[model samples]
Target chain A: MAVQVTQAGADTKTGVSGWSLSIAPRRGALSVVEVIVLAACIAAALTMTNRHGVDIMIRTFLWAGLALAWNIAGGYVGLISFGHAAFFGIGAYTSTILLLSYGISPGIGLFGGALLAAAAGALLTVVCARLRGPFFILSTLAAGEVTRIAALNWRSLTGGAEGLEIPAISSATDMVFATQWPYVGLVLSYMLLVFALSVWIERSRYGYYLFATRDNEDGASAIGINPGVMRVSAMALSAALTAIGGTLFVQYFLYLDPTHIISPDISFEFALICAIGGLGTASGPVFGALIIVPASELLRGWLSQSASGLYLVLYGLVVILVILYFPSGISGAIARGWAALTKKKTS
Target chain B: MGGADKKEDQLMLWVEGVSRQFNALWAVRDVSFSIEAGEIVGIIGPNGAGKSTLFNLIAAAIRPTSGDIRFLDHTITRAKPYQVSRLGLARTFQIPKPFRQLSVRENVMLSALRRHRTPHRANRLAGETMEFVGIDHLADTSVASLTVGLLKKLEVARALATEPSLLLLDEVMAGLTPPEVREMMAAIAALPSRGVTVLWVEHVMMAIMNVAQRLLVLHRGQLITQGKPAEVSKDPAVIAAYLGEKYAARS
Candidate 1:
């Protein structure tokens, strides 16, 4: 319940003496900690020389961005969609197809992919508007599976199971980079953009409406907030952002395989990261990505030849523990710890 | 009813033969009533009297089976809840439904957002609304920490934040202590002065009788009696169905 007025100069119109923005402040140390973590991420991306290490950094940033995007629907709006991979696949395939078939630059193609994914998201939300809780979740999973099957069989459009590859010619317009640093930079920018958008949504009037709908739909509708419109818009916005992340992923990997792109595992990973970091908070998914991605990558790298799926078992265990013990995730734990510390000091 | 001639003097709410059935049973049947602007109207009934169902029908939370409901000049019988709410009508639940995760101020701000469209302006109005409802001191506190009485006040604060011309209050003083009930009565009594026409559904006879300008009594999903509180209290049908004979003798 700690309310922070948006930074002193952020708005001149917030003239109420005691009223707060209701956006919980990071308190004293959490803000500093976040800044340090962000700085370390940038430093690792720019200064790391090892190709393996840089690859992990790139994945971390990309997944973080994707998780933040998913957090809009899953965390803020309580949609809990497991079908987000459809949007991601749509984005990746759209951009890749535009480039391979139409000779379009991925830079411009990304927008087309995002738009299509957003429409799909909106459609999914509208179709499943009446479904709540587990039913809604199952519908999203079914949608993802349907998208995967369609991509696998539709040989004319999606290139079928053979997948598509952007030739590694290293063109700037095509988003094929010679070095890994640019991709890292690109994804870091994407993460920052999603993070900024999440914060804005959390503070805006629309954000309040969205939160109200999630917390109590009947109460919200009783006060003129349309839950249907809120859910649809949140899902669409989340899908569009996630699609952008997908496009970036394809651009960096230079490959798009239906099995991999639209995999339920990828969708689960996005939700898992958000759950690990903090679902609704803007910075939760960022922290989840930064921590979980590198840890998983290093674990996989170590256990690759000796025990291939051992890392997966360990990853699942950690996720289970975090979910069971820290239901609110890492950011929530930090906020709680911060509150306890301040209370002790005052008393 | 020369309704077109006195457009400015139109009723705040008009319910005509509205009925709602669930499964095999009728929750409300053939109910009709109208409230003029700036009047405090009370609806009282025993358990299962369809008072809450009536509120839900008017608020468009549920559709009526066979009748039309008008708020101001708009037909809201088939309207969505948000549409009805947007057209100067707001209703509170019988059991308080505060956003459990939000602060009291934030809960009010959700309703305030409907009018202000900016969190900054909404926050200002929400603050005033909370103060008006005497819960400003609990603004930043979580709704989870509130008592039943405070939760009810928070509900009122939230509804008031919407700046509704007509407010539907459902059992605002149900679980309150005597002093808390008095405080709530005072707060609700002040609402009509601000140009809000209230349709209050309550089991608390003392509070409703003291405050409401008129009373509508329901029995078995039908309006059994409608008149001033003193007259309704003395009605033979109302006395036999609801208030016991001893209460009738006392009144």
Candidate 2:
């Protein structure tokens, strides 16, 4: 068992001294690889984002941000909530409702929505505090169902589940813009914002508490780490970010419905991207979104006339293979490969 | 009782009438004990003797079926686990659970940072703790590559990093070579000078007998014997339950 670890995995400079994964705190130092990845993200956003692929690009970036948010609770804190769409719905409805009802700008509504979603996240965390494993997952799913049902029934607030369409009067104050690049720019900024936050968390003393809590809740608690508070805060933080994505999503689509916004599938998609790219690392969600969004979109575009479910079938097949074989996802595989390469270079 | 519970010089940990039931079986029944500020106490029993469960009850990992537990004047039977920790209590698992991906230092730093906010201070504390446990050189090594002896050292370091007033060690000397066990025994013996109180649960009789100032023997969830190692070893009930009569005579 010990021999396998030395032979296989390491992050940086795995020679005589030993190997350490770059994803570690490293006292918050940015490695050469991290800088390049961030620069590439910026460069891709600037040049490749155009009129045609903008929708896919925008969605991908937004989903990336959302996934990073979800990773805090799902990966780091180990809550494994399957009902994050409720938070997404809260963001969408908060912004859209305020905009439509009181003429409040989506700008202020964004904060309002995020705060509300965070509160909801805190509530769910408290409710699920005693639950573990599948029970906790089910509690979250049930919470989503409750949110969806409530939204559907609350006609005056949510338009009786038929959804509300944003008025076509586009203005700068309304968060409305002319082109898809601006939207791309908006989502790209969110992606970077979430990525930075993830980095901050990884480096923070609090992040250590989170990591310790997840791996050994018993050990952590015995040493003065509060699992309950950590779980609650992680949920709130994750929900706030996901809510921001929801606000952006509604702004882009100009429409909202209870079903699509609060669906279990939306929640699954957010978590799946992180799971696919890498569950715990900050970069995982970005890689996951970058790959999953484009592949699915291009496939859908190409296979549109062929069959309705064909593209999704192929997409599902790819996800299954990644999950089955590379359980750590794309980002982890890259780290291991990098370690191996460095080891080979030295030898 | 409450006044004594709050006395600064009385005892570091006080457990009164603590019992834990799972389904129908009484895993731990009517167990009660107290330890002072700087004493090394050992808890020994056969398998399924509820030693780990008692540790869990003390740490608030699981609530007791009934009874009160006090640490540092705080009622911890219903307290959160981290809350128990914040009062300066730490423990180790019988089965060592090192975070596989993290470096050994990172594992220790997780506990060290409880009181030290900055990474520099935490790292320094982790280094000192590792050295104290005699694994400072392996600080940067991944936990995945550690040998069982080194893993036990890391576990000790991890708990010690918290700078707890009271430390509970579960089977630290289990499955170790005789030399490795001796080295760990030296570390355990030295903890009292650093202002630590210990409740060590061990199956390795010789190691505990050498290091512990006092021993508490448990059988079927009840503490069967309590005294110095020599006296407890000679008790007929202790011998009947654990050490056979011939081994008892030999001792």
TM-score of each: 0.93, 0.89
DockQ, 0 to 1 scale, candidate 2: 0.41
Per-residue lDDT tens digits for candidate 1, residues A1-347, read: 34322221111111133333322333111255566677888888778999888888899999999999999999888899899999999999999999999999989999999999999999999999899999999999999999999999999998899999889998999999898878988999998888878877877778777778887899888898889999999999999998998899999988888999999999998999999998777778988998899999999989999999999999999999998877777876776666668779999
Model 2: pairs clashing at backbone N, Cα or C within 3 Å: none
Model 1 chain A weakest 10-residue run by lDDT: A6-15
Could you tally the backbone clashes for each prediction? 0, 0
What is the C-alpha DockQ of each candidate? 0.46, 0.41
Off by over 4 Å in 1: A1-30, B1-3, B243-251
True contacts kept of each: 0.55, 0.44
Q: Which parts of model 2 are misplaced by more than 4 Å?
A: A1-29, B1-10, B15-33, B46-54, B62-69, B75-78, B144-149, B219-225, B235-237, B240-251
> Which predicted model would earn the best TM-score?
1
Evaluate all candidate structures by whole-model CA lDDT and list the values in order: 0.85, 0.83
Q: What tier of docking accuracy does candidate 1 attain? A: acceptable
Whole-model lDDT for model 1 versus the true structure?
A: 0.85
